[model samples]
Target: MITVLIRLLTLRAENVIPEVIWALMAIYVLAVLVTLTSVWVTFKKLEGRLLWSLIVLLVPFLGVIAHCLYCLTHADVDVLKQFGFFTRKTA
Candidate 1:
């Protein structure tokens, strides 16, 4: 069993990660990063790091909407100290 594992592990790296897969993965990661950054910037300071991060990372697009709604509803955190949809116009 060890020999079989060793043989597979020794195979060429190119065969393991195809070019198209790599490109797609890079794009996906970039999108996730951008989305996460947007969430961070929009909220200014997110309370309960674990819950917010999980919501954003787990659901991607829908997570953004949910987080925005959460920001609107939750009053504990300063959701208007930075880039908020309503705060900018009133200022």
Candidate 2:
């Protein structure tokens, strides 16, 4: 195992493309999973449901984080209001 690890660490520059592609594919799969889980739990209202769902499916990496933050703030307005500094009420 250690020998294989050493060989990977010494990969030539030309071999990096396939490795990068695989890494990106893995990240995309993870983002899809996150988006699916969010659909099951977070988004309920019909307002931005389709829009946010598309965003989560299309943008790489940060889409999941964005969806999660949206869900967080939407679901916990009171929690944020308790902090006072974290929430601004619109007049």
Q: Which prediction has the highest TM-score against the true structure?
A: 2
Q: What would the per-residue lDDT of candidate 2 be over residues 1-91, giving only the tens digit for each residue?
A: 4644454577755545555668668877987887767775665776567777677778866778887777676667666677784666799
Query: Candidate 1 clash total?
Result: 0
TM-score of each: 0.42, 0.49
Alpha carbon deviation, residue 59, candidate 2 (Å): 3.0
**Candidate 1 regions off by >4 Å?**
1-17, 48-50, 60-91
| Model 1: colliding residue pairs | none
| Tens-digit lDDT string for candidate 1 (22-75) | 665777787667667756665545575556777879886787677767756774
Q: Local error of candidate 1 at 11, Å?
A: 27
- How well does candidate 1 score on lDDT at residue 12? 56
TM-score for candidate 1, residues paired by index: 0.42
Instruction: For each candidate in the order shown, give its overall lDDT on alpha carbons.
Output: 0.64, 0.69
